[model samples]
Target: MAKKKALTNVELCKGCRLCVGACPVGAIEALMQVNKKGYEIIRVDEDKCIGCGNCYTMCPDYVFSIEEV
Candidate 1:
């Protein structure tokens, strides 16, 4: 089976951190860098992500997009 992955839109994200809390595999982390909007962005650790969609489901701003790779 193909591996599952998550893509984040830093500019669209609201930095709510719901995705970070919802992830069962702890695949997401807050990056030190901020986007042009000045909101802290998150990234998925591909090695750890299971793409369970928890992050996608929890994000209120629709920042995450998931796919199989």
Candidate 2:
């Protein structure tokens, strides 16, 4: 199987928790620091992520990018 990954662009995130709720594997978490856009951004735990793209699909702000590696 091809390795997959999820990338989060903090700048575009709007502190929405939809992606966190949508993630099936529970791979995402909110960090303490806010981004330049003044929103708390999410961090993807690549080790736990299955690259399912749930985050990408659910995010209103288009904060997530997924691809095969």
Candidate 3:
């Protein structure tokens, strides 16, 4: 299998909430409050994510990415 790039780096996020709408699986969830950049950080809910890479494309900050199987 190929290695997968984990969707991390909430610090770099701007909390535009663009990725949330793009994810079909609803795997991404808003974290505690907001980051230093004033954007609501998100985390991948492994069970819901299908590795569709939808959020990956929507994220302008390149916050999201696909991972290996």
Candidate 4:
């Protein structure tokens, strides 16, 4: 079976930090950097992520994508 991973679209992020807290494995974190819209973006640690889709569900901005790896 193929493995799965979570991907983030920084441009669509709104600095809400919802995904950061929603991550069950603590795979998501907020960066000091900001996007073009000036919203703080988040990064997912692929090594730590479990592809549970929690971040995708919690985000109001639709910033997350789950894909096979």
In lDDT terms, which candidate is top? 4
Q: Model 4 segments beyond 4 Å from truth?
A: none
What lDDT, from 0 to 1, does candidate 2 have? 0.89
The positional error of residue 10 in candidate 2, measured at the CA in angstroms, is: 0.6
Q: What digit string (tens of lDDT, one per residue) describes model 4 on residues 1-69?
A: 888889989999999998888888999999999999998899999999989899989989989989998
Q: Which stretches of candidate 2 lie over 4 Å from their true place?
A: none
lDDT of each: 0.87, 0.89, 0.76, 0.92
The lDDT of model 3 is 0.76
TM-score-based ranking = 4, 2, 1, 3
Superposed by TM-score, candidate 3 places the C-alpha of residue 26 at a distance from the truth, in angstroms, of 1.1
RMSD of 4: 0.7
Clashing residue pairs, backbone N/CA/C < 3 A, model 1: none
* Consecutive 10-residue window with the lowest summed lDDT within model 2: 29-38
Alpha-carbon RMSD to native, per candidate: 1.1, 0.9, 2.3, 0.7
Clashes of each: 0, 0, 2, 0
TM-score for each of the candidates: 0.90, 0.92, 0.77, 0.95
Residue 2's C-alpha lDDT in candidate 3?
62
**1 or 2: which has the higher TM-score?**
2
